[model samples]
Target: MSNNSNTALGILAGAAIGALAGILFAPDKGSNTRRKIAEQAAATQESLKENALDLKERVSETVAVQKENLGTRVENLVSDVSYKTEDVITTLEAKLKELKAKNKQLQKS
Candidate 1:
């Protein structure tokens, strides 16, 4: 299996074993043990929720940064192309003017 799947399975197996051990080794009465387990589960769930939210926020910030970087790159590329196009047009215009002047001189001769 993939590394990600293996890691997930390992984590799940560890959690299950830990929970079972906690229940089996508890010194308190059954009712108190059950209550403690419930409280611990609730706390763990809340912690996981907070972690997930933080991960999502980080991912969003990363994407925003990447998008802004891409936009800047695209703008720079477009500006470069525009500048090159203007240079080509100016050169062509100068060439045409020179050719026209040469043609007029040839016609006079």
Candidate 2:
């Protein structure tokens, strides 16, 4: 898991333990204590759901950005290769022209 996930997990765990301890230690009727525990459990469940949704959103966003970056890099590499290929072709053509000229002069002499 990521650092952010670990930190959030740790925080959630700590809050849950703290809340349980506090509610258990309170001087109240058994029914009241049980009700408080149930309420706390429900609240914690909602919090976990929200956190999971938020993390999913962040992961999706990160993946999309990375994909876009990869696409751009690929395009740049292809463009560079195309230009270099053109340059190589041009150089070869010039050399061929030079060789043909020399061959013609020698043939005439």
Query: What is the model-wide C-alpha lDDT for candidate 1?
Result: 0.80
User: In model 1, which residue pairs have backbone atoms overlapping below 3 Å?
Assistant: none
Strongest candidate by lDDT:
2
Tens digit of per-residue lDDT, candidate 1, span 1-109: 2464457556755785698678769788999888878876776677566656666787789899999999999999999999999999999999999999999999999
Highest TM-score: give the candidate number.
Answer: 2
Model 1 worst lDDT run, 10 consecutive residues: 1-10
lDDT, model 1, position 15 = 80
Cα lDDT tens digits, model 2, 3-109, are 98989989998999999999999999999999999999999999999999999999999999999999999999999999999999999999999999999999999
